[model samples]
Target chain A: MSARPRDPMLPRSYRIESVESELPGGEVFSWTLRPRGGELEVGQPGQFNMLYQLGIGEVPISISALGEDGTLIHTIRDVGGVTRNMAALSAGEEIGVRGPFGTAWPVAAAEGHDVLLVAGGIGLAPLRPVIHHVLANRERYRRIFLLYGTRQPADILFRKELERWRGRFDIDVAVTVDRADASWRGDVGVVTRLIERGGFDPRNSIAMVCGPEVMMRFAVMSLERRGVPARQIYLSMERNMQCAVGYCGHCQYGGHFICKDGPVFPYDRLEPLFDVREL
Target chain B: MDDLAQVFAEEPFFSGFSDAQLRRLAGLARPEVYQNGRYLIRQNGSADRFMLITTGHVVLKAFVPQRGMVPLETLGPGDPLGWSWLAPPYKWHYDGRALERTEVIAFEAEGLRQAMEQDHELGYRLQKRMIEVIAHRLQAARLQSLDLYGNPAGDLP
Candidate 1:
């Protein structure tokens, strides 16, 4: 670590190596940055990048996947103008990138404890890194559980990978859908219901939850009720983040700047402000 | 066969009940097996019994005017299904169907009702559990209606 502040504000040119459509409106972009003429820095999982769409605007998107050969993956859902444009991007196109900013999941802290990673819908994107990290070093952690809930079967991201992970004996993967058609023979309900049958030792467990605010609130409540300490539970928050640094006031939460301070914070620190509604 | 008392003790719905109370509950339950596609309970049907599933899967669904049967939840072992038996008029709100061959213990509503009436203490305990179930379901239904994941927009609570 140098105090050099490497490429803080300058935009790097990342060539989109591949683009894959997920579900109906979602897409995943794989990029290999050639900043001036070199490789882009490897970003830690749970971190985000400021992606610039030239004339449109820049949006902070989380690092969804990391390639073994050093590529950055971003999963985008077409919600607004920037995201819609991101979805329309084709392979070989180049996008401007600012950084892999903000804090990351507490992977080290979760070691030795049962790791429960819970995600809902597109919320799974951010937590994908944690999944990769845990699986890569499976021996360090205790039981690794992933409880994911999506809107429906078609809406599930990383479908092939989820199936692969589910097949593993060392990991516990429980997926539920909000609604199911006749074809879906899997579990159906809110994700929290899975916790009742999840069988994790709450006292020695660390839970990471990411999803809609309402969904996250309920997940946190369930974990808390099961005797998991508020300190050990973590939540990846959703907010309007601009600048991806502390310079702009766009993503301020009470006193914290989500861009620099956190997108991942312990439930104990955020308990007071978790769902204040007016905040 | 799964021991009845042990099975009853494991359900979260009956987690804190005393062993004596749990034994009485186990005694009241009648074991039944259902094949796939069987309707354990139907909407608007008389809810004369509630079921505690020990093995296999059951789906809770509601039929909309145009949407046929909309699956709400697929419950598995250790789940308590149908609280409508405790409420007035006693009609099932949703259809409970076995998606696969299933094993469950059906608790007779009339017998339990009579037992409760005879023993006010038992009635109070059972009523407390039913109220908890109703409140929990109300909260779940409210969350479902929010449809938070269906149409997601960023930058808002």
Candidate 2:
């Protein structure tokens, strides 16, 4: 029997065009990818792309931004083998790309409601597109509150855009770090502390959060205690995903696949899974 | 009961219980011994009681044909072994096997439930204690996941 073609869900080819460090500590890195055809499947906010460097294997990386031209953008932290290789890729080097999978942020539902975006450390990557979309169509939403936290000021990703977002009238941005540096003058504590100071109206707001699972859990609890309905609290989950198509069981949590059913899920639907460790 | 109080005091779940309350709780606990490789509870079996290890180790294993009896976690002295007894659908979620000759104090769930129902203040205190135990375990699990799957981010040696 003729062997079936390799699944289309797997990327055929990828070329890294350039790399840059947005943060001083060299922990968080960004890359510009040049696909062979100079084209990529357009993805919505909160979806992620599976990136593979030849011989190194694959990882799920959120597409950080949509360029005015067509180049896809990714912001990655140097945390693992595949990522370490990805950060080292020079211009014209080959990599692989798959997906642009998982549910996107509820940008449509978020329209007309006050939007509260919470991110910690590299958690900001998944929320980047939503932030861009809201700012690009600024009048669609009432108010936008962005609460971000990192281990330290130096660990914050997209520092430049954070400044720009801070300047916008409708966007109220608060940044906190676990430890403050000499040049940093902002609140310091857990990210939940920033949420307390932001004073969001949970009744009319839809809150989107992405971070370490513990932080997300705490943020969800804080939001719920402050009156945000579980349905209105959305979370972006990070799990090991070998196949973006949901065939691999690596990303299964309860009945949902983190690669297919989420990356973003309504908090209420995910409550049971949250309680079970290693799900 | 007083003899068991020292064991209870050393357990993380009961550490928060006052010496007096823990002594009182020990009154209701019954010590049981198991040989190495014995099954303490089987997955999907009835969960009529909760167990707190006093000595030796137990392995919480879940059956998977691909990897028979995948060891999920190891519980040593002081860890509460079953959470199923707390709520209905009271069936053991995973198989528990004695990794070594083990001794544990088994607390009858129905008895504790009755005791709590009879005393609102005690119920609230015990419930609060259980919540703390659950939270601590959840935190440890999350940290373990980060260590296994997360980027070390310069924190690792």
Model 1 chain B, TM? 0.83
* Model 2 C-alpha lDDT versus the unseen true structure: 0.78
Tens digit per residue, CA lDDT, model 1, A1-279: 656656678778888877777676454333333444577677887888888877777888888888877678887766777877777777777888888898889999999999999998888999998999999999999999999998888888888899999999999998989888767778888888777665899999999998988999999888987888999999888688877778878888888888888899988888888767776
Interface RMSD of candidate number 2: 16.4
Worst 10 residues of 2 chain A by lDDT: A179-188
Give lDDT tens digits, candidate 1, residues B91-111. 999998998999998998877
Evaluated with lDDT, which candidate comes out highest?
A: 1
Candidate maximizing TM-score: 1
For candidate 2, write residues B101-144 as lDDT tens digits. Answer: 99999988888878788877667888897786677556544533
